[model samples]
Target: VLLGIKMSPEPLKKKHGRAAASGEKRSKRKPKRKETFSVYIYKVLKQVHPDLGISSKAMSIMNSFVSDMLERLAAEAARLAHYGGRATLSSREVQAAARLLLPGELARHAVSEGTKAVAKYTSSE
Candidate 1:
């Protein structure tokens, strides 16, 4: 699904190396930390439900649920991609993510809206 997003799956290290050899200075940006979708979902879920009983079993269940939710959110985001191209996720993406991440919970509505509102402000380039 991320194929058409034009994102490079591999780091452009060779390109950077060539540029450096040619006396071109790279921006020196920090490398991006690798994260699985499950990890991303876990963090969001943890933020939403800070005290989910505090047991290993409970944490395991939460992780499972978050992974499931991330799958759902990814599907929704893929659907919404029909309206946009390889752009950064927008309000729609957040809504989709929140809906899947916190279904039937009171925080869902607020988080969904908040994601959109925050995206609007932060997305200005």
Candidate 2:
């Protein structure tokens, strides 16, 4: 049953085609190069703990975590923009997305930091 609707199961049929019956596995794509956000992460880490050192493995994990978070934020912001009948994502959408994704004080801090960064960047230009 799907969504409260009962469904009958159909017998599975064997697929016959060169694409399916070739018996040859598709070649795996080459792996992407490891992207390191090490420099930026290290800078922040240093700020938090002056003498702290991070391992390459830790850096890799941090990079993956940060990249994943940023991707989710962008996707959420895009969704917010689309929900509001807009084609382009703006700062407000991003801020709203952050609030939705982050918990309480974290969202406030993130928004404040982002605002300050944007202000500094705009003023510098």
- Evaluated with TM-score, which candidate comes out highest? 2
Model 1 stretches with alpha carbons more than 4 Å out: 1-53, 83-88, 96-113, 116-125
Say which candidate scores most in lDDT: 2
Off by over 4 Å in 2: 1-34
Tens-place lDDT per residue, model 2, 33-63, is 8667889999999999999899999988999
- TM-score of each model, paired residue for residue: 0.39, 0.70
Pairs of colliding residues, candidate 2: none
Which window of 10 residues has the lowest lDDT sum in candidate 1?
A: 16-25
lDDT of 2: 0.88
lDDT of 2 at 117: 88
- How many backbone overlaps does candidate 1 show? 0
Residue lDDT tens for model 1, 1-125: 47665555885464643556453466788889854444555576679997653555666676777678668777776666655674576666757656655648744765756877787888985
